[model samples]
Target: MTSRRPLPPPLELPKPGFGRRTPPALFQPIMGLFGLGLGWRAAAGAFGVTPAIGDLILGATSILFLYTFAAYLAKPLRRPATFMEDLRVLPGRAGLSAASLCLMLFAVVLAPYASGLATGLTLLAFAVHVGLVVAITLAILRGPEEGRVVTPVFHLSYVGFIIGGLAANALGYPEIARWLLWSMLLPAGLIWGASARQLLTRVPPAPLRPLLAIHLAPASLFTMVAAGAGLQAPAYAFSALAAAILIALVVSARWLVTAGFSPLWGAFTFPLAAFASALVTLSQGQGAMSGIGGIALVAATLVVPWVAYRVFKLWPGGKLAAKTNAAEA
Candidate 1:
């Protein structure tokens, strides 16, 4: 709501039977698990933490993705627009895009088993994601004035290509990944600047503050991508930036969570895991950065799964669809 209107008050807990169907936002937890798994895997490589721990998380993430994907897929049978319903809203667009991005991540997960399948899924996810970006752009141009508002979630809409690039790299297509990831720098920087200006001037309500955690994801993701690409200068530069953002978030943690455990807290998972993964990569098992990475890894280990649990708890009940639209409307 920081875009053009006043922020709403904190969310009151929904009573029983809030809603029956889950929105694409369900992908948030899945995104969290993917981040955590990748972070753990990075930690194992850098810090000699047991690889099995990362493997276990990845294993569980695959199963969870299947279960949740099936559940969400079934929604179209009940209401066809459910496929694109969430995309029509502000926050939900991020979830839908995350769902698309997770498809790419899941594709990476499948690479060890079926390289061909993984490659196709990566392409398909990117195609869907591009379509989403185009659709959103056309929608914004085609009609409703309110849809013009840009929330922090827009990061997933345009800047999300960074994930596609990461998946492409993981899938053994570095050239493709390079083009996709590096090309995103412009959009990412622009979005970050615009979002920061909006937040600084307006300061969102408590319920929405959790979304600020999102800003952390871009820097960390960029750092990991840069480090993995062997671009040390930019990697360290982004690492420094990520550390600053992490410190700010930590210092303001109390204020950020003033709404205290609403569904919105799902916002915390990715940035935490992303930074852990970034630090682990940047540290490469040495120096003060490594120590910081260890701390971040521990925090991600503790928090990401808890977030998955909390998000799923909200899945079965709550007027999520209703409240989501009204949150910034």
Candidate 2:
């Protein structure tokens, strides 16, 4: 009998370039800024301050949304394994949250210019957002005990729901919005409490210290969501709490920045934008606070582009992940 020849092992392709290494979560800060800028511009129009600025910011938001959406769509084709890998981990899973936020932001931006298109986009985004949130929540619940590290970024998953609720309100679905908002309250509180406990117990690694700024995001985002839903009492209360958290974060800015220029710095961008947006919402007609909100909005606008530029420069070269790993080591 002739001996059967063994088949060769399957070929393993080399990892794709920096582009493939780019996480969907990387777009979170960029989209957050675009959303904040769009909101501020709308506020400006409402106040009769600079209606032209609204159009300008809207154009910018459109450009960013298109670019980011294209990149995310291409990601699966470029690296099929990334999707499954991201699903396997807590931190990587936050990418879905970022994707949901980006979709909602797109819906918001599209609303004024194209009502039918905006409604269609909002419906699509809402469906996707709900699916992702439920999936991520289940993963966490069924995950191993060690997988439940309560880092600031983990809160992004819950933040996604909050943003979706706001988007629902914008789409004129107050009941749905209210349901979404209330549903997230317990999860958000648990995450915040766990994170706060972790912080009190142990200093986070240097690479992760930058994410401490993320602690401010939930309160800031909730304030805006509450205001959007016309819960004035809770909205104002959350606004005060958000301001306090912002001040505390600012006081520790030196310690936070001492980590310096890691990709993790992206953690700082979205939270600041959330705070500024919340302030703008609170300042609707309040004189001095209005001036303060305008200033905060301008500063956030400038800072976001700088952060985006840094992320882009490092991301394309694959330095962001490399630097983060080296620091952790």
TM-score of each prediction: 0.87, 0.83
lDDT (Cα, tens digit) per residue for candidate 2, span 201-302: 987776667778777777877877787788888888887887887888889888778767766677777788778777777778478766766776777778
Per residue, candidate 1 scores C-alpha lDDT tens digits across 243-303 of 8988999999999998888666767888899999888888898998899888888988899
Highest lDDT model number: 1
Give me the overall lDDT of model 2.
0.69
* Candidate 1 vs. true structure, TM-score: 0.87
Q: List the global CA lDDT of all models.
A: 0.78, 0.69
> Which residue pairs does candidate 2 place in steric collision?
none
Q: State the lDDT at 288 in candidate 1.
A: 89
